[model samples]
Target: MAIAVAATRQVLADSYKTLSGASTVWVSLHTGDPGSTGTAEASGGSYARVQGTWTSGSGGSLSMAELTFNAPSGSFSYAGLWSAATDGTFYDKCALAPSITLGSAGTIKVTPSFSVS
Candidate 1:
């Protein structure tokens, strides 16, 4: 089988200002049951991180650079904390590293840089 490097577009809200190249950081989403209670993707859960870059400005597209899956043992810390909601704190559904460093690109679509496992 062949592995493909791809990702979907992640848009930025007006409040976020905009998405830039290497400016934003996000994690990958895995396929499987979230498991039992407290088995969320970033909360005491397992996930992977895919590094990439955005070519354009704050509203263009994302170009992946690399990917890594580093699952923590217990507890979890998302990129940013939600103002009102705690569950929506994480930026990426699947995560390992701290965050992706968006480049000069402001905002654009995003995708995986390589084959993520």
Candidate 2:
């Protein structure tokens, strides 16, 4: 499937003002493609938030963040950013490279970057 590369209009607006300062940000893994809607939540099969360090990116070039799933479960082809740590609005979507498969061991890292030009 083709990758859906779009951030929410609200996210784009808030991102410039106070999105970076939002508390309890989270990144979730998704097997379902973002499609045209470009929004989704992790409340179904094999979907869960990765437990890792979420380093918010700095600078006016790009508002980005990195997530390293210490013990990511299942498999996913896409990733998303949420405002709340759990059960929040999906602000952005990203299709992973080569997909991510979590087995018995190892870690999964996903770096989602945002830029406006």
Highest TM-score among the candidates is held by which one? 2
Write one digit per residue (lDDT tens) for candidate 1, span 19-105: 322344444332232333223443223344333333332332333444344444433322221211223333333342544332322
Candidate 2 runs further than 4 Å off: 1-17, 20-24, 34-60, 63-65, 71-73
Give the Å shift of residue 51 in candidate 1. Answer: 5.9
Question: Which 10-residue window in model 2 sums to the lowest lDDT?
Answer: 52-61
**Tens-digit lDDT track for model 2 on 10-110?**
34434643443653356776756766443443344334575333333333224335566554355668777666666655556778888876664456677
State the local distance difference test value for candidate 2: 0.54
| Local lDDT at 26 for model 1 | 47
Candidate 1 error regions (>4 Å): 1-22, 28-39, 42-53, 57-60, 71-88, 91-117
User: For candidate 2, what is the TM-score?
Assistant: 0.55
Give the number of colliding residue pairs in candidate 2: 0
